[model samples]
Target: MNITTPTELSWIILLQSLIPSYKKRAERDTSVPDAANKARKFAQRYGEILESLKIDPTCQGGPLDIILLCKLREQVLREVGFKDIFKKVKEEENEKAISLFDNVVRLNDTIEDEGKRLESLVRGMFAGNVFDLGSAQLAEVFSREGMSFSATCQNLVPRPWVIDDLDTFQLKWTNKSWKKVIIFVDNSGADIILGILPFARELLRRGSQVVLAANDLPSINDVTYSELIEIISKLKDEEGCIMGVSTSNLSVANSGNDLPVIDLKRVSQEVAYLANDADLVILEGMGRGIETNLYAQFKCDSLNIGMVKHVEVAQFLGSRMYDCVFKYVEV
Candidate 1:
């Protein structure tokens, strides 16, 4: 879908902020002797790597940088499984002296193996380094502007997504007879807001049902029915249309004009009615805290939706997280 709104871009910006914070913590924690010892042992066991790179201690850099290097050294040692003599740098007798000696040796060796630089060495150790994933990786898909993902993660910088990335939403739902479509929504981020609106309009056009599943209140960027209305307000102001709004179980219903709201949670009968009658089901989740999908899973399971097939879609922001889309097939 063409993500053509500034609001959609906001979603990218919000998520980008998380990468640097995580990386900084990772770097800072690397200095701990207990953790460092394990890391060093991991490195030493992979002897060929250390031998090839020749790391050194006398290299001039910030203390934090040096500590991070030490952390990398420790990681290398542990990865290769050298259990014996893997001592925490501070705990050892003559800690400073020992560190100095080790640093000198690493520095000399590292200079000799210029091609196998410390950064490259550490990067190789992780196979896929965390920092690499956040900046260049995530920015490629989400941030079209000249957003530096690498620098952001390394420096712990924050950036917000533009609204455009979220403008157009696509919902794919099918009935046994191919007569309907449904849109499931989770977060109230600009991306989802923009995406869902377009998707909802399209579903209505096709005579299908569009359901938006969100929490009762706003938690971070995830929206509530009120917030959804606010988005609708902005969209209506900009585009002059509010044609295909949902009224399914997940759709918000106002009990009174004074306060535009609905029961944050819909009834089981309502959900079942939508599920049974739906040619397809789109289940969205709440964004912050615990995910809404976990609750939805229980509901789907209770409804005897049968075997749930999970599809891992993408790994964003250098994280090990897998973005999943699931399919439940009825036997």
Candidate 2:
């Protein structure tokens, strides 16, 4: 159950590029009283830890990598009492995305060709992935001018993406049907409600049992298991349908992950159990899909879909910021 990392990835370079942005986010966190002051303290302590690791690598006391760095950052944030820094924004965006869910689905349904429909759904996934507050640039843009789901979908970068596998995946889509799919979801608001849910609905309609594994605790704006359950509850009718699709086949699991980046070997027992029979495994968003587990191999067919939201990631992939990754592998 150990996930693999790409040999090309340099933990030192990636950590150096990412830590500054993360510190900026922590400094801007307004979830606690005297927020700016407390955030500065958190950043100071976190930076000290990183610097110590640099001065004496062995001082890290564990692997000096993205997972360890992110865990350290979160540990510092919690020590400063900054819990769920983006909670309010997540709630607000979730409401907005919920209101637009039907319209989004109806539009997807209008596409008569199944291939085109699938492409559109995947595009929607990339677009919604932009609602991430974990990215310093996107967070600022979102705070200044809120995101538009449809606009984003329309504005995705032209095809032949950095890691394009859509055409191949479409062929598989037309030729096969997976019995069970486990999507490691990311972000709140449009990311989940408008993007992933619609795609998951498609799987449910195709008679696949789907399990959405969300973070057990808040990390950036990534949705939590409880929040995902509530979102599903609101989207489903009393008859247990979501826009005419039955949701009985859909369920949510806690990922036992608190960082935006995930280490598959450490997931909750619940998700591990659910994934046991899965025929397809999808890791969504930049954190899970790109930064941490882009090259991970699985026993079943796997897809890693997300938008490259960080400069470091884009550099590593040799793609521009906001470029999409739709890598698919059939085993």
Candidate 3:
């Protein structure tokens, strides 16, 4: 499947709009030693590189596209010795989300209508996705006052989302069970535990073999493959079950990605192997789903779900910030 920035998007404009926020985030990352000084240097070096790419398109020795730009930003971060800057926040949020996981699952279980339950699950995913710290505005608000999952769910921008395809997806969900489902997960804390795990659990209970593809390394606040494994281990019972559902059919794969945005062609061999037979593919996060691969097509069914966090993205979609996208395609 081919994935590129939307035709209407100007690469330079998008890059310019995004760079300042990213620079601020890097500067605020206290995890790196002498972070302020390092971040300034990082910003200067990254900006210089971008200028070179603009002056000479072939200067980077590769396509100077959105994916390439994101990768370049991350490469600079690592070079500046900033690794997993959100580690502490991720751990703290994970603990809080895990503590509330059972209740969230039980709430879903109590919903009698299948369609409504699925809607709730989708809403939960959107709500959990709001914990992202990559967006400059969100990071500021999150740092000042914590977010409540339930409150966020209730407050999501009213329906008829920018790319609402949830109704069609619900029809398929009710009529058939996919043999295998691959979910490209995003973020840590509520995003993975509260949002995605319950949805994946439902799939497992429905007899689908589920593969969760996570980052091989950290990017912003996205969870890593190893961290996901540990989270699952902690949530499972002595019987090796998650809130009573067997985890025997659940698996995790490293996506061989270090950036929040993913390039499908560059995923790990293991992920490619697992996805070979997956009848359903779900990309869940603003970076992986909305900003990058919103228009990507797959051999089987695919769902790209996320909330628009950045103004540039929201404007591109002609939607308000925090508006959700549930673009579902069946091939």
Candidate 4:
């Protein structure tokens, strides 16, 4: 008698889960929905692609990376408007590069109106609820308070409307005791800076361990692990030095008050070492769709965490990177 190996069993279980089935949510009536079917189809297609690439989804990389990829794939599904098994559009569908570039140029010019034109465009591409919290003008005008025009402009015209809160989600985790926070970093841009800085601050304040998982520089202007190391090396005190960890491919100098950096490739091993005594894990998303799609996939396989679809982000991007994360939610 041949007993199934763990690897074989895992594949079987994964395949079985991918098959369409009825699902019932907690505190909800039991019913069969196409969500499962959609997920199954996506899985199948994804599996095919991975197979073609000769990569085993289960073991091509660390679980953390896999999880990030899953999260990213989910974002792609949303952006491509393929939430159902019946309707799916690949990026190649819009591979008209020159035309897309023209549209982007047009998008930049259309934001000139700031208040009306920009809002309208966002609503059109991402739906009205994208800014349900309120438009950029919903808050106090900092421009009138001696802030620089550039600062005010950046704030009001966020690239991806993660939320005003995201613009300042910083915290101190001194008493929180979190093990690590994963940052799914994207390009170095206004949105990426706005989304992560605040979150890092808050995590530091709460004393939660933090990990900024980002690609190696210099793809995104956002902080890379290598860059972070230099910054930490010169750290003097904790006042302005928000502490966390960054993952890239370089060693960073840790002077206690500043955040540390880790190579992305070694994330799993580093995480295992840290998780033995931490409180929470935070994953920061890259501000771009491709990065987000990759992050989603990695998160699913590794952490099993749900990535929030920031609808406003898609509206803010105005359709260039439509499925970046914010496009999936209902308006």
| Predicted model with the maximum TM-score | 2
Q: For each candidate, give its TM-score against the true structure.
A: 0.32, 0.92, 0.91, 0.31
User: What lDDT score goes with residue 210 in model 2?
Assistant: 95
For residues 1-331, write the lDDT of model 4, one tens digit per residue.
2343444344333323422221111111113245445445555655554443233434433332323333434443443334322111111111222123233324434454434433333232222112111112211221123223123333333345433222122122112234344444332222223234333444444444455544443220233445444433433134434333232212222211111122334444544454344334333332233222323333211221112233333433343322323322100
Clashes of each: 44, 0, 0, 61
lDDT of every predicted structure (CA atoms): 0.31, 0.87, 0.87, 0.31
How many steric overlaps does candidate 4 have? 61
Residue-level lDDT of model 3, residues 44-109, one tens digit each, is 888887766666666666666667877887888789877766787888999999999999999999
RMSD from true fold, candidate 2 = 3.8
Candidate 2 clash pair list: none
**Alpha carbon lDDT at 257, candidate 1:** 14
Which candidate order results from sorting by lDDT in descending order?
3, 2, 4, 1
Off by over 4 Å in 4: 1-179, 187-195, 220-222, 238-268, 271-280, 287-331
Model 3 poorest ten-residue lDDT run:
1-10
RMSD value for candidate 3: 3.5
Sort the predicted structures by TM-score, highest score first.
Answer: 2, 3, 1, 4
